[model samples]
Target: MTAMSPTPHDPLGAVLPPSPDNELDTLRELVSSTYLNHDPSLVTIRAGALFARLKALNRAANHATRAHKQATADSRQEMDHTYLGLQNLLYEKRHLEREIDKCRQFASVYQDIPVHALEDFMQIAPEEAPLNSPNAKGAPQLDLKRKELIKEKEALLKESKAQLATVENVKTHIDNLMKTATDVRRKVNDLVQPLPTTSEPGQSTPAS
Candidate 1:
């Protein structure tokens, strides 16, 4: 009967001198068992899941940004409509002022006429002359159309004001989403950066 030599092994990943053949076999079994104990594809699957989630989040952020841009475009269109209102209002106001001037000018002419002349003008009946004269029939309709235009300008101004408010609200929401997305991306970067890269066991870079 022969006594066998005691086998020695390094436990702390220490460099070793020549090891006995039995010890090498034991070390190989230890490595194989450890590898078998954990799932081989778990790391890759988890990394893929993380990337997919980030991609989805980025797409949502892009959509949000587009929606915000659309809101801006809507606001600009509304501003143009407001300018149209203002321009039309100014034009009508000027036209009304001119019409008032014409009315006053005609009234002054009547004032210059003697009272008997005014009485003489009143006695002339249009029906006996021609009531539906080309110029006479259209004045009231023209005045009504101008009044309607003024009212439309006012309504458009009010609508523009409401659109302005909606634009502001959309801008605020977009700002908040951008900030939140930035934070989320930063967190994802931190999580991904610490993952180990494939390399030889002793080939680690020194801590920076």
Candidate 2:
């Protein structure tokens, strides 16, 4: 006996259950068989079912395509945003590195310069009187003091000059007196010289 092929209603060869992998082939065979059997009612019913299935499949495919396109666009936008963020980070890192390098250079250049602590500097620095204080000497007071000191110095200088001039006059008078005494002594010596006696011929002299 010959074996019979499976029909649409008995698609498993009457021994096994139908599988999803062969469903399209089974449908094709069913369509062909219906046309070959020339049954109008069966053809009309199967055609309607096939058309509905095709429409459902088309709708599902269109939805999947739209979802895929939307997902791709979203992924691309996210990637762009991430790339921009990375670029910004890199730029900031470079700027920071440059700033650090400049700081290092400055440190090396000024290495030998002294750096005083704030407390030490403050301790050594001169303190100013408060502006609001009643007795605080302002610029006008300082100027007045300076003028007084200058006037005193000028008076002292003039007095010193006068004293110097007096000392010079005294010295000149002493020098003139010394010269006059020398002249007088010379005149007295001339006047007091003993008369050279011509008693050499007489041969007589008075004893003192």
**Per-residue CA lDDT of candidate 2, range 84-132, in tens?**
5555545554554555455444433233544444345446656773544
Backbone Cα, N, C clashes tallied per candidate: 0, 0
The true-versus-predicted C-alpha distance at residue 208 of model 2, in Å, is 99
Q: What local lDDT score does residue 140 receive in model 1, on the 0 to 100 scale?
A: 66
Task: Provide the clash count, candidate 2.
Answer: 0
RMSD of candidate 2 to the truth, in angstroms, is 62.2
Q: Once model 1 is optimally superposed onto the true structure by TM-score, how far is the C-alpha of residue 156 displaced, in angstroms?
A: 31
RMSD (CA, Å), each prediction: 21.4, 62.2
lDDT of 1 by residue, 86-160 (tens): 555455545545554554444323335333232343367545755457744664675566566658756655665
Worst 10 residues of 2 by lDDT: 193-202
Query: What local distance difference test score does each model get?
Result: 0.45, 0.47
Off by over 4 Å in 2: 1-27, 33-35, 108-110, 113-208
